[model samples]
Target: MNSALQKSSSIFRTAAMQVRHTSVTRYIGTPPQVRISTAEKCAHIAVIVGTILAGPAWVLVHLQDYKK
Candidate 1:
């Protein structure tokens, strides 16, 4: 019974190793081209920056109310 358990454990480990090695899909080619107009690029950046700043700005504006 001990030998049987050891054999099954070894088989499970071997299968897991093979699956781990073979399952990965690698990308070797150049990335696909993407085009964005200047206006659109500016708008995207503005949205991201505004979102990051809005949280802190809101907290600062409400600081007096929070102290109550």
Candidate 2:
């Protein structure tokens, strides 16, 4: 029974060590490259426009409530 417990604990420890090493290796690996293409730029502009439009749209939609 004691040897069985030791073997299970050893396996668990080994798995944990492997996970740690794999995570560390992944972090150390080359990161994905980024390309700032025209499409990406357009998408960013759309996001910014949407974000900016949301505020004014919200204000316009709720403008009547503020008058009271």
Candidate 3:
């Protein structure tokens, strides 16, 4: 069991590292052609926040409906 857990964590660490490398290489290395303004940046942030919130919102709605 200990060995299995160690192997799982090792695999996860490798996958996480690969994802980080890919994201940096794909986005961090690129220069933006049209730089986003502050308002645009705020909007993008809001969209991301809303996307994250949506999952919880859906779960809450379902729970409410289930109680009815």
Candidate 4:
């Protein structure tokens, strides 16, 4: 179990290291396992937030139908 945890943490560390720190143009050495660009990250966030909001928003928009 401890070994598994260590392995997991190492993977996470590598992933974190691959991420872009601040600048969009400043490149890190390792090709990121994840999207490292600011635009890409923002787009990903937007998609996630939109997806999350969609469920509740849709329900709210159609909520009157369930009232009967």
lDDT by residue (1-68, candidate 2, tens digit) is 99999999999999999999998885646664976889989999999999989999999999999888
Among all candidates shown, the one with the greatest TM-score:
1
Model 4: lDDT to the true structure: 0.85
TM-score of each: 0.52, 0.41, 0.45, 0.46
Candidate 3: segments with Cα more than 4 A from true spot: 1-34
Q: What is the full ranking by lDDT, best candidate first?
A: 3, 2, 1, 4
Q: Cα deviation in Å at residue 11, candidate 2?
A: 0.4
- Candidate 3 C-alpha RMSD relative to the actual structure: 8.5
Per-model CA lDDT versus the true structure: 0.91, 0.92, 0.92, 0.85
Locate the minimum summed-lDDT window of 10 residues in model 4. Answer: 19-28
lDDT per residue for candidate 3 within 1-68, as digits (tens), equals 99999999999999999999988786565687888899999999999999999999999879978788
Clash pairs detected, candidate 2: none
Q: Listing every candidate in turn, what is its Cα RMSD in Å to the true structure after a full C-alpha superposition? A: 4.0, 5.7, 8.5, 11.3
TM-score computed on alpha carbons, candidate 4: 0.46
Model 1 scores worst on lDDT over the 10 consecutive residues at 23-32
lDDT score, candidate 2, position 58: 96
In model 4, residue pairs whose N, Cα or C atoms come closer than 3 Å (at least 3 residues apart or on different chains), thus clashing, are: none
Error of 1 at 66 (Å): 0.8
Cα lDDT tens digits for candidate 4, 2-62: 9999999999988776674445457668866875888988999999999999999999999
